[model samples]
Target chain A: DPVTGVFRGVIAGCGYFSRHHLEAWRRIEGVEITATCDSDPARARAAGLAAYTSADQMLEKERPHFLDLVTRPETHLELIRTAASRGVAVICQKPLAPVWGEAVEILRIARSAGIRLMAHENWRWQPWYREAARLIRQGAIGQPHAYCLRMRHHEGRGDDPFPAQPYFRDMPRFLVYEILIHHLDTARFLFGEIETVCAELARLNPAMRGEDRAVITVRHQSGLTGVIDGHTLHPSASGVALGDAWFEGGNGRLALDPNGNLWTERGCVWRNDVAAGYRGDSVRAAQAHFIECLRSGAPFETDIEEYLRSMAAMEACYLSAERKAIVSPLKFLVDSQSE
Target chain B: DPVTGVFRGVIAGCGYFSRHHLEAWRRIEGVEITATCDSDPARARAAGLAAYTSADQMLEKERPHFLDLVTRPETHLELIRTAASRGVAVICQKPLAPVWGEAVEILRIARSAGIRLMAHENWRWQPWYREAARLIRQGAIGQPHAYCLRMRHHEGRGDDPFPAQPYFRDMPRFLVYEILIHHLDTARFLFGEIETVCAELARLNPAMRGEDRAVITVRHQSGLTGVIDGHTLHPSASGVALGDAWFEGGNGRLALDPNGNLWTERGCVWRNDVAAGYRGDSVRAAQAHFIECLRSGAPFETDIEEYLRSMAAMEACYLSAERKAIVSPLKFLVDSQSE
Candidate 1:
């Protein structure tokens, strides 16, 4: 018997992103990822744990402390029900539901079951942004007036989706939901909850089902404006800068360069030492946070209800583009109750 | 009687910015500053030339080949009319009038008199943007889908406009019409004429008469969207980067840093050598373009009719903010005649 309440776990889904989940779980102290399951037999075996093609079988046999869910959105509701039926905790990856309402429903079910559910929103866990937010609260930049994050990359030009994430070819709610939700969440995490989301989306690449180019603007409760942008078609031979940002405040400015250096107006260049940690350090940090919250009775930073703001923001972005008008995410959430 | 047809000229308004005009004019080989005029005696005399407090006295007495009116908008129509009545060629500064209609009226007077007119919109002449535009046309970036320029400064925090020009404190349309108009023209210079201009403005600074922050988005005829931003409250300790831009095309990216360097996705860092010429190289560039157009009977790039596009775009930005809706410049121009 594991008398320490060692928190044995099983992580489902072995896609390319699943490797980070497995690696992160191994690094957390007092946690053992006792088994791994994937529909693909080879992927399941490759995780170097007790492999199973059946998630139900793994849950029945392992009876772990948590079920780490890293699967696609379509499989999320069924998996969540499966886990909740057994009364286990869950730390799931995002696009928790391709449909925003479905995500809300999933959260409602999990909360009713009294399970500790943490969505894998790791952008806020990234060191540079965390430090930027810390300094902003410390008046390093004063009251932020404008914020921008550019997440342009070159991995989306093919006629079909790239090999790594082959399913992306048909992600109808692509950039804003799949990739840009992280930025939207980060903005909310750094700034306060947004008041309105106004976005203009463009589908520049023929290969993708949804828009690949986005210019999303948000107004925060603090009367500041922000932009989260992606230009996948924007060519870059060498500057593989992702999530580069410039946050403007009343007294000073803090900008994050692609290379993890934060430039401030006070002539300080704080190299993001946190980002310099081992390859999966943010994942490790996130996992640690989840475990700590689970053990100590502290709430998860990206708990079911808390992470919904990000999820609502993502939906607002799509609706903003769809309607060609600014959509107030909070208002949308409130209005959806009547619907 | 310098026989090089040394286009003798009188420059009006020897205010703070007039020095750049005078310095640039002096650097141009065939132009001679016959006189300098300012409403303030001290300002006029400060310009190392035959000085007069009244522009009328200078134009009547000097009878130079051209007149440069660099004074405030309130005096532009009278000055341009004064010069045009004599059929002398003239170059005037921007905000041709506080009202867009008045600007159009002034241009009509100049055109009817056949006076060669150029607005001293110097930003496009800046070496870095000039080169960036050149490269974009040369297929450096495959086909621009997005562009952004950040024009932020600490000049707008106080009730009294800073030392150089105190009148900015009283200007009713500050950022968009005064500062961002250059960006509007530059966007047209780099991309095609804008089809729609959308802007959201805020009066973040309590002391200013007009908006201190603006987020203006434009859709170019080429199916690209661009943003021009100003956040006065955003703090920056030392990066006095002005007109910093990131232009994204299908194949590559072009960025201009405040330090006069253009970064290309091709891994080339082309130092903008033109910026090294003199304090007023861009002014000189604008003046040179004016003279070349005057001498060659070539129309000005910012000629009255062509320049109306910039003026119209500026009007659209203001109306967009006022209406909280996208305003088409050309459509607004057509609609304004009815108003």
Candidate 2:
């Protein structure tokens, strides 16, 4: 495939999100998904590729140029290790691992093997945030100082709310880990690095195990601060952008309505037209970036080493809620170095 | 005069906010502002009352039944002390005192002298909140669990903003003390007693000595939580309500728009009709309650003892921001008892 100028790719875990990855790889110019693997043969067959129930068997036989790991957080490490030993590059999904120690191990494995790795953090690639970043750089909001995203999703209510993802009910750490982590990553992508985090979490829905509501405040190293007021049990007008957002600056403020329209004091700056794809076709965009970087030998925007900082910030949110104090994510990173 | 049902009153510190108090007092029946006093003779004379440079002189000459203290936070303790010694019940403007110790001393003087004291804390008396309380009690938004107020004010920008209150630029503590304290009081009035407070404070404008922005999170004793996200240097649609608010509950959510209209998921629940006076003429409503309670010998709703909790919560916000940890307002109250 390399001699023929084609980049062959294969995906592990043909679960709910794997469809997006498959479709994206199909659309990219020079990339081809050689096969799909899942523990469940039915799910693997659903991908309509060279189906296999064993990822190791598929990797050894197909020997694809890249592996896309879309499995749950716990499965990520072993899958990455399998790919790394075979000298196959990886694009892994986020939270890298559920806990900090596992995440550090995953990173160490990737670094030691020298395999190209990227975390599939696609929220920042969502057209609205991308447009907001453009306008911010264009002086649309003039020296931005703060950002706020009020996220409301009604799917976490009732006894069996998350029917699509039943595993959501049993998770000890729910909203911040599974959901708001994307916004945290988007915050980092838009505003510089985060320095400190403080959060107040509550479980509004008693049927669920973890906190459903949270007010997370983060201060960037640039002294620009932000708050993510999120609740999964509340009624929201639109789920397209998750919720509405406002980015405040000295001269003006930018607002992202639920319809994915970005507005400044002047008027509507950008409008989101296509609603068919996944979150403004962000998965496709993110996949395209991964493939392009592999071909060009350029680094991924969300390279594994750098993404550990986002993981640390997410860890700090839980720590802040537990200790009822502000926590520095840098401590987690510094401690991880020793490990 | 007691038999004839006339209540004579004197007002001290005839400055900017004093006008609202004076207007409200004039509108209330069976009460007369017999005189006004201020250190600046021009401001004192502007009230169109018999004016004096010394508050003690006005209190002696007028022999009013009550004193309305509309002075700054630093002046509150001395004014309350002066009024209490002369057996003049006082209605003092808030922050109650700039610090907890002086607030305790002010309460001690009022209690020992047996003079009735009420804090003129009136944001909760705003018609929109009154309607919200009614709706919440009516089970419109079922079992409210959280509340959020995103407050934006454009008056704190540029080199010389806040022209009406130039002293605003020099205060060691600006927004939280002078402004957001009202929202905190209203939070308690709407939700319940606050148990813990967490806040992140920032000064967006270099001209101000204190913080111009804050994200304050409070957990109530009743398990309800609220976030007040406020910044003074950003553009907002309306200054009438100061910002917009959302109250989330089990069944639905309640929204308060900038025009003071309250909305539920079904439709507009409450529409604010009158725009005259200060914040829905809440000052007038608050003054009316004070006079009615005085004549009927009923207790003031914001009696010094109860109002202290709101002040303590305000103090806890400052402490939380300073220590970078959650602080309990009860600790401040308990410590004040020993003081």
Candidate 3:
């Protein structure tokens, strides 16, 4: 039986991932959306939760078990720090902060205060990716030497309102931190830790201030090299709609489908041996694991300390892209972790 | 009727394009293959022409009108310079030399000797590219914003020998010069000259010295931007195996197919309203144009002087890849041209 607690929290944003998070929380037993906050009053009220003008007001009125900070990256550190100070455990998004220094600071504060902090790095919990990881561990793909992950979309303009935020639009490290972070973390999750990164960032469209395209090469600690290419400007009809992982090893090539199927090549023939499905219920599974850890005092699978290193890796990529030189994640992390 | 004693030449290497160049030379009437040379002694003797151990022997004994230096890039400059000094007006292959300095010196020597040099930049002669150029000129694609050309091969091992030497294996730039030169030249041919270039080159297999993958973006003198991506590493069963070109204007979008087909989209619908095919036969057509220019004393369509700038652009790409920074082709060319 699940532990019973009064699960009252404030959702500080209503955007792309916010809807999914809100819906997931609603489905979880004993969880209640006590309050919601957004700059747009209409969107905040439309969520059907008790709408509040600000996070401070909501926290004062309804003290909650967890603060689900789904706002833009710029607001993440401040909210998490405030939540930690106010004695609320925090569940922040994939990129803990817009910058690496702030991400470290957030983690440091949470660690010192002994408050639980979970970075919503859902890619590791992604069903397809998890299955690929399992197959890789099972030696289905031999010793992986090289991997490629690509996520591309042609349409840049969208009806989605989240990207309209001033920070999202103005951030120079948009592609590196926003989208590629998931893939970078996924690379770390599958191939141990990234040791070095060399990357190129381009703003293909003149109308956009931030980069819409990136091609990054990561060298892992396990001697596996990988390239992750992300282009938000690619055409939608190009059949490669989702990112895929292609692993080349001594035995043969194993291509992990976007839907979690495994295609292996042996001798001269290729076969899709795995069923086309997710490994399991990813979001609920991760949420359940987090909740279990929170209740039983078991160690969290993806702790804030581990995620801070990934954030440092992303910062190295940004510096590499800007400086046009290879950046060592280890060096960056050493300095970042020192403080 | 064409003038007599203009020049005579021999097809030194015979392969796919050798036959085409032979056919074109035969049609020109004045030119003659006094001899032919192929390292494969069997094919050389079978052609019923006096065969020689080397190009120098062919030049000394046969004294042909010109040397159709159809061999690989490594032999291009030496063969052209030898023929030009012997008073042979030479028509060399695209990518006149393996590297920029060699190409520059070849042009310098050819100019001093009063010998005409023409690079077989044949994409300009392809009817479809010609039509695309016409449409762009006619404002059909408006002021061409960003263009993408993807040239790919499903499967080809490194063992396949062509013409003389295994050009692809020795020079990493062969893939850049032999294949991508067409697209780069076409982009410049249609969109005007390139000003600055930034590129990333990858060799997927370390055993293969040549780069099998490349993603290059150029900023043109016309204030238009473009991207070119090519790889020999794509899956064998991938569909169509061609490239795409996107031209964005104030009005709508115009796209081009790998085989030179054209499509225009305005508001709602897309219309495929262009011809289709390899468009490679334009090599012969372009050669024909060069022959006509020689006969009429008209300026060649692809002037060697003008093409030297494009060669500089190619060199800039190499420098950028090596130095990992943006390079200005014009700045690199200034010293060479002045010298």
- The lDDT-based order of candidates, best leading, equals 2, 1, 3
lDDT of 2 at A141: 80
How many backbone collisions does model 1 have?
7
Give lDDT tens digits, candidate 2, residues B1-339. Answer: 568798999999887889999988888889999899999999999988899999989998999999999888899888888888899989888868888899899889989999999999888898999898888888888888778877777888889978888899999998888889888888888888999989889998999999998989889998777888888876544557888898888778899998789998788978898766898899999998898888988998899998999889888899999999988999989998876
User: Would you list the C-alpha lDDT of every candidate in the order shown?
Assistant: 0.80, 0.87, 0.68
What is the overall TM-score of model 2 with all chains considered together? 0.97
Lowest summed lDDT across 10 adjacent residues in model 2 chain A is found at: A231-240
* Top-TM-score candidate index: 2
* Error of model 1, residue A44, in angstroms: 4.1
Which regions of candidate 1 fall more than 4 Å away from where they truly are?
A1-3, A41-62, A158-161, A234-241, A250-252, A263-280, B1-8, B32-65, B81-86, B111-114, B157-161, B233-243, B265-269, B272-280, B336-339
Q: TM-score for the first chain of model 3?
A: 0.86
Give the alpha carbon lDDT tens digit for every residue of A19-56 in model 2.
88888788788888989999999999997789998999
Q: Tell me the alpha-carbon RMSD of every candidate.
A: 3.5, 1.6, 6.2
List fnat, each candidate.
0.34, 0.52, 0.05
Instruction: Give the per-residue lDDT digits (tens) of candidate 1, residues B53-95.
Output: 8888898999998998889888889888989999889888987
For all predicted structures, in order, the TM-scores are 0.89, 0.97, 0.74
Looking at candidate 3 chain B, the ten consecutive residues that score lowest on lDDT are B268-277
- The residue-by-residue lDDT of candidate 3 on B1-339, one tens digit each, is 236655566767765567667766666655567777877777666567788658878888987656777776778877777887788777777778777778888878889988877887876676666767777788775445455565655342334522243445656565576677777787788888897666667665454577656666666776665666666554432233245555654334566655445677543223334233224457567777777777778877677777787778878777877876657788668878787
* Model 1: per-residue Cα lDDT over A229-335, one tens digit each: 77666454323236488887777778888766789756656775454333226777888899988889999999978888888989988887676566778865775
